[model samples]
Target: MSDHRSESSRPARVPEPADPPGTAGARTPEPVPAGVQMSKQSGTPGAAVPEPPKVPAYARQPHPRQPPSPWGPAGRQPSSDLMKIRPAAPGVIPAATLWSVLATALLGALLLGDGIGLNLFLVAVPAALAAYFAAQAAGRRLRPWTAVWAVGGLSLLAVPALRDAGWPVFLAVVSAVAVGSLALHGSRGWLGIFLGSLGLLTSVAGSLGWGAHGVRDRMADSRGRWGVAFRSTVAAVVLLIVFGALFASADAAFADVLGSLIPDVSLGEGPWRLFLGVIGLVGALAAAYTAAAPVRWDALTVPPGPARGRLEWALPLIVLNLLFAGFLAIQLTVLLGGYDKVMAETRLSYAQYAREGFWQLLWATVLTLLVIALALRWAPRGGARDRTLVRSVLGTLCLLTLVVVASALRRLDLYVDAYGLTRLRISVAAVELWLGVVLLLIMAAGVFGAKMLPRGVAVSAAVGVLAFGLASPDGLIAEQNVQRYRDDHSIDIQYLRGLSADAVPALDTLPEPLRSCALDEIQRTLRGSDAPWYATSWGEARARDILGDWDPGARVRNCQELGSGDQGNERGGDGTGGPGGDDSYDPYDPY
Candidate 1:
């Protein structure tokens, strides 16, 4: 109290020191809490400084809340220029734009010319263009990968070989194009590829109202104009119906002419086909657009939420590995025992032996791959030792599974050799071979960790498929089986005759009656068949030359009826239909 009284008696106030260099002026005042007030300055001599009175909340108006703005609490000042501008384009597309796109696509389809191949090429062009326009309408920029996608798309459209490469090849080409396009447009990775593919499959339905508002508004505006036209058309239609009925009643000839003009088309006829085509084409365009400008799927690349159970990954895989190992042991025994010995021991016919385990082996191979994937995803991360064990087991399982695939392939080969090759067996064999390659890749992934395994597998699978398509397996299979027939005299003449025109050239090597009969059946099948313009390839022309009007269906012949010397003659046959009388048939001959 004495110190306070003494300090209050001082006459002169001390000046505050200046702030240090570079410091901003004294910090702004913080909001004072309620019931608090600034302390009074000491008075001059005996005079006391008056304190500011506290104001009640109701009596005092709070500073008007500053309007919110991105700039700051004070908000941004208006620009000198008065014209208002939009900040940026939104991520979404407008509805009217989509309707316009759909209309453009339908119109394009109508003008693009007929045939699936031509339409496929034509539709792609407009789909890409519409996608671009949609991006612009939505204020988005073209993606960096657009050029790459464009090149790929143009290649697909321009290459006649690729276009005519059959449905499987065509689908592969389409998927590649779609994935490349999506990737260029910013989405990437396996998930992106999957999403892009899904987009292609369902985009048409998915985009049902992608940009509905603008389209609806435009329709509303046009409705007034359309209303008058609609009413007038309805009135004319009513008048025609009424008068036409009367005229029909009066003149039977007129009625007959009217009926002829209108025609009684059924649901299964041309009108339905046209309707379906229109719907299909429109949907295709929508899907293409959606695929090209898909909603963001990149975020899905984020790691999965919550780790899966450790046992779920480990226990099933351990059991599966044991099963696969056991299967491999049995397979090894069969593989080593020689085909004849195994068949004798099992008391099974050659065909039964070949057919028995192939499908089961194939299924097991598929299940092994799934198990590896699951194990990689959820295996216990308890310690380095656990991870090493899992990887070792998975890798071993994959290697063993590959052995199973090889066995399955061997079985298929035997079956094909016995029955003569068919398209189904050949295709399945190719798939199994690819699956083996993929398992080998998975083994590498297990050893080295899955850094680029998915990418490696995808590329390898794509290359394998493209190669398989180009190899013309049908032609190759026929060539091999025909040579086999020449060697063993065990060929199924009936099966050979039943093969598609694809096998005609290969069949030309058979002796007189069989060769002639096979050609005839091929010719008949060719005549009855209708290949689309896009489906025809150079191979078809070669097949036609070999067929040459022979008729297998008209003639029946057994091995003996083909002549006892026929086998000897076929073994020496030249490339021509007539058999050469020497063992000159080279099984290794590619043609």
Candidate 2:
């Protein structure tokens, strides 16, 4: 009895952990089926069953938090990414990339360094650049395009060698800049590069000007500067050629501007006035197109083509430059009265004119800029702008065409003036018309489309024609006819080269028709070997064909047979006289 009582009072020995749900208890809990949970037991005999191992922090929980399988459960990937860490799929191409790259590559290649080479190189550069730019712009960003850039870059290395031979350094620099800028896709520091270039040019030009005392000396010293500047300006021009930016309405606006704003400048109701007026009218159209232009920095954008190279900024810049040049000429005329040409003494004639022209261009620039601002600030989200421009241009064209017809009908004697109804005049008018239409269309479409057509061609032709004509048969002819001693000397020398005999036959001296027969005879029998050694590059083949009947021996013998103190002896009576007499002629004595 004492022992039982003491045992009962003593604390029970430490109890064991409750068995896991399916495991046996001391009595062997009635074999619980698989699905059913085992009942809890008191610790005394079976304490309230220990809460199911209060979810162990590290241990895998039964629900949802299933352990990863050895079976490699992830689904398969695309074949492109077989590597350890898969790469991203190729990114979408930008819509403008093709156009930009094409323009950059072709223009760079074609106009590479702006005629750094000789005659062949001049034609080759622009063509090559155009093709390359076009190809890139269209599509096909092939390895070939990259190779073109490399070739252009490498060509720069040859500049030093070509320099003394008359190859330009500006082209080399431009080529190098283009390749490098394009290769990096404007990613690498382009700002640093442009600043460096500006520094180089201004510094070099200033240094040359300072070193040389006179304009003559300065020009000789800085031919390289001019060359470089020209190329760079051309490259800059390439940026301005925005595709498709003009119209008929714009032409009317420009006509109004020219007619009303112009000072006492008299175009005088001649064909020339109409021709030039038409061109101005076209410019107005282009201006209108510029007004509604999208935001694009032609100077900054690279990767070349017609759009990027020839169109984007090229046309507008040229117009600006020409205007500037004209204004300078006018100002100079006002001050100096006569001297306008850029001769050996007056090197900055164009620059001087350009300075004044800047004001006129400034007006246009401001007007266009305002339009652009309006576009940005409050452009309506519709086609209202397009419609308005279209109507304006169409109206202008109708008026211009009518005026042109009226002018043509009024002039009968002007036709005799040669230039009145010539192909050149017609071409100028056509160009104006086309430009006007383009400007109007561009106002509707914007800058991107404006440059795609014949804008540059039309404008250049119109201006060039005006220049040539203005300095032409009337004004230019008289100017040229004013022969000083030096001029007379040059003419006498040319005359001597073709003069057949010491005494041209009376008939040969006659102006035309009957004189041609005698002239032909002299050319055939005497000119090749006699008094005049007729070996001009021009007409050499034609002269040979026309004068082939003359006896070479007789011609040579007569040339040397003159009984005077100085006779132009041909052949020196060389025994080698045969057909055409050794394929050479005696030198013509001009003095």
Candidate 3:
């Protein structure tokens, strides 16, 4: 207390010695949080200021959000003018664009038609874009010279293709460009643009090659980027015309294939009309799907969702689609008035057909929709809603199951027709097959995908294509598609069971029926060869040496020679196993 009194009796406040540097007399605001109030003025004695605390590392420094204006007036505020008064063009697409497009479109042109070829050519667009994006990602621009080089490379490849006018060459060149661009710039955007232009060029080339381009003489057409658009229009028109001409010319071709089977007047005309009709329907279906669904075309994929164990969420959409497809098929037939009946006794046209089943389908659809509305209404809240979703979905599934079961119970024939997911139409079947495979792929791509199922499915599909009918043990039916493809003209499998010399040797080693078939194949194949594969000399040598003739001492009689049993090493009937110790792998034998 005495010390405090002594200090309080001090005369005046001591001032620190100045003159290290004279004060600038500038007022400094105390460091504070942004919105804190500051004192109005300093006291008579200079206000005491606390030493500023060290800033924490986690504190963020303020910065301008955007770049400074470029077109600012001097000493005045700059305007946010990223845009110039004018922009320049990239210049005329080089001649190489034509070559690239022609190259790309050649395959579809030869195999399908110019219309289909044009669609294939669009593949180049993404390829080009891929290269551009890649280069951009690597912190580089695709210079004009690079574009020139890429185009030039594509052009160089086309010289041979143009000379040959073959799709093989075209495919090679465009693919080269696409792949080369991806390799060089890593999927640049320019790759897409360049490829698109090239595809258009190719489409035009395809049209010309197919003898259709000259038909567009009425329009002013220039070849380049615009050439694609021009060619697309010309190709569409020409294809339509060409189809018309072919239909008129080949009455026999049309009548033999479709006239008796499909009685619709349009279908009776020719294959072309049928094809176009199918394509148009498919396109309409796709467009309608896009319109109805929230998903974009790019995202036309099945994504991972709630576990399949909780099937309630998934079944509704699935049933809806199935019913919709059925509804559409019936509705289309009715709307098109495609049905016609031939007289039973007279074998002549009887009555004009009106379509059936649309009204019933409509009523059922309305009922299903009402059920869905009711389900969504009283569902649980938040994530628990998923569980509540259980009821409606199960209900819908039960309803659908009942329908399928009821249809089954009504009549065996009707049940097969109703419940069979595979539609009768060729187009529908193809679509179904494609969708099935895609669905498999999607499931494979999921987190807890159908692993065991995918492997078996993939193997079976491969076996189907690889074995075809030729791989069958019976030799009468194909291992996979059997006679289905032959009747339908949908699949062609001439090259299945392509065994090498290292694999199964000659035909006779195989079990019967197959042995005869393989022998037949050998005979047919070796017919024209300088050194025939199944010639008597080669056959004998192959049978004697590679086939190992027979085991010790079972008298082997030959189909070719009776006493030649002495020439071929014979096998004894000591049937414990083979001479090599164990050759018996009988599929029928149980352990």
Task: Specify the highest-lDDT model's number.
Answer: 1
lDDT of each: 0.57, 0.32, 0.33
Please give the RMSD to the true structure for each candidate, in Å. Answer: 16.4, 28.5, 26.6
> Can you give the lDDT of residue 558 in candidate 3?
26
Q: Please identify model 3 stretches exceeding 4 Å from their true place.
A: 1-93, 100-384, 387-508, 511-517, 529-591
Q: Ranking by TM-score, best first?
A: 1, 2, 3
TM-score of each: 0.58, 0.23, 0.22
TM-score of model 3 vs. true structure: 0.22
Q: How many residue pairs clash (N, CA or C atoms closer than 3 angstroms) in each of the candidate models, in the order given?
A: 9, 61, 27
lDDT of 3: 0.33
Model 1, span 1-591: residue lDDT tens: 232233433334556456567655745333334344655336423223334456667557667554566665456655532122111323444443454455555544343322233345544555566566665665567654555455455445443343233544464566556544553345455565456445454455445555454446656877876578669988997999899889989999998777644424345555554564465455544643454355555445635334445566666767877887787787778756866766657776554566667877888778777766655666666688777777777777887888889889987765554444655677778889989989988777777766666556655655665566556665666687668667665444544555555566677776766677656656765676554443344555567666656456545555345522434333233322122323332232222
Candidate 2 positional error at 223, Å: 57
- Write model 2 residue lDDT over 376-468, tens digit each, in one string: 233222376643443343333333333333333222112112111222333333434343343344343353443433223322333333333
Candidate 1, poorest ten consecutive residues by summed lDDT: 80-89
> Measured by C-alpha RMSD in angstroms, how accurate is candidate 3?
26.6
Worst 10 residues of 2 by lDDT: 287-296
Q: Which candidate is the best by TM-score?
A: 1
